[model samples]
Target: MTVGFVGAGRIGEPMVERLLAAGHQVHVYARRADVLERLVAAGAKPVDEVRELATCDVVVSCLYSDAQVLEVLPAIVAELDGLLISHTTGRPGTLQRLGHAAIVEAPFSGTADAVRAGRLTVYLAGEPEQVATARWIISSYAGPVVATGGRGTAMRVKLINNLLLAAITQATLRGLAAGRAMGIDESVLLEALAVSSGGSTAARQMDARGGSENYLAAITPFLRKDLVACRDAAAEVGVDLSDLLAAAYDGPMNLGV
Candidate 1:
């Protein structure tokens, strides 16, 4: 399949490489031309604007947030006639708003390492036929393409996954901080925690290396976005997430998870 990508930041760049390796004719559009020079050399035709993705069989977006996705959809749907895959997580409503396009949500799970290793799992959501087409395109890089549900289901699932990720990462940070305060060897606490329910993919990652509290600050913005989405989703369904919201807000401030 001939694939085109919008956004060429951290995740986008690696995904472009994966698609290229799978022998797809890939094209990419980025606001910053310099950032994508290597991709251009690697056979990815780079375009200055999003509208240039008109000729692709599938156009994928790895945008930062829901609003950004909305901002770009007009260009995508107007110019491209094929499936539009949203690689951004937590933006179901945005997909539904793109009229006429066969929109699919295929959010990436796992780290950049997973992307590079082609071990990523993408949650596919859309009309059944479009989703099957997306699954075929996604198989070039991702391991399993599970159909989560139709329309916005993938985004909601992604938000829930982020909630757990934020909670666990915060908890892991506090555990390390507590160990640090008491002068206990970080490795000992990490090893012990890995044997308990507190252990997670994030916790094990931190344990594998001596972890620090400072790392949480770097990821604060991403976690904040997750909190906002979670709160909004809960409100939409008349569910209360006051405690979880409070915890999410307090986690970084208190250095407690």
Candidate 2:
């Protein structure tokens, strides 16, 4: 398939690389020349403008935020007749608001490393035909393609997943802090947590970072972005998340002992 790619940031780059490796003709566009350099060298064509990608069979967006996606959507919508698979983790109603029939929500889970390793899980939601149209492109980089049904369903699932992720990470950090205050070695505490019911991907990440502070420093900004999106989505549906919001904001600072 001929694919157009936008936003070659950390995660985006790997996805594009995977598509290229899978024998797709990927045309990429980004403001940063440095981000595009490696991909261009690896046989992907570099387009100077977003509209140049109109000829592609599919255009995949992995932008950092909804704002960026919205900003780029007008240009993409004006030119492309093919499918738009958004990998941005944004609010539930975003893809619908774009007002394009060809657009589909395909929020993904996993880090850049996971993408390169082809271990990323994809949550897909759209009309049956649209979902079917995007499956080939999405499957190129992601592991299992989970169809959640309807445009916003996948985004809601991704947001909820991130909300639980934030809670788990915060809880793990607090547990480590409490263990340290009681004179338990951090490694030993992590080992016990690993063997106990408290074990989680977040706990494993904290162990990899050697503590809470480093992990928080590395991921807080991204986590905060997702948490804010989740809170807004919750508010739209009359759900209150005050306690979760407070804990998520406070945990990184106070719980990183």
TM-score for all models, in order of appearance: 0.89, 0.92
Candidate 2 residue-wise lDDT, 1-257, digit = tens: 79999988988998989999999999999788887888889989999889788788899998888888788877887877888999999888776777777888989888788898888999999889989878877677788889999888899898888878787887787888898899998788877776678788877766777765666777776777888788889999998878766666566443221
lDDT of 1 at 213: 42
Backbone clashes (count) for model 1? 0
Root-mean-square deviation (CA) per prediction: 2.6, 2.5
Model 2 ranges off by over 4 Å: 253-257
- For all candidates, what are the clash counts? 0, 0
In candidate 2, which residue pairs get closer than 3 Å at backbone N, Cα or C atoms, i.e. clash? Answer: none
> Which ten contiguous residues of candidate 2 have the minimum total lDDT?
248-257
TM-score (C-alpha) between model 2 and the true structure:
0.92
Cα error of candidate 1 at position 99, Å: 2.1
> Candidate 1 lDDT, tens digit per residue, 1-257?
78989977887788888888889999899777676888988889887678878689998888888888879867878877898988887645667776755888887676667788877878888899999888887776688667998877887787777777777776777777888899988778878876888678666666655554444444556667766777787788888877766655555334222
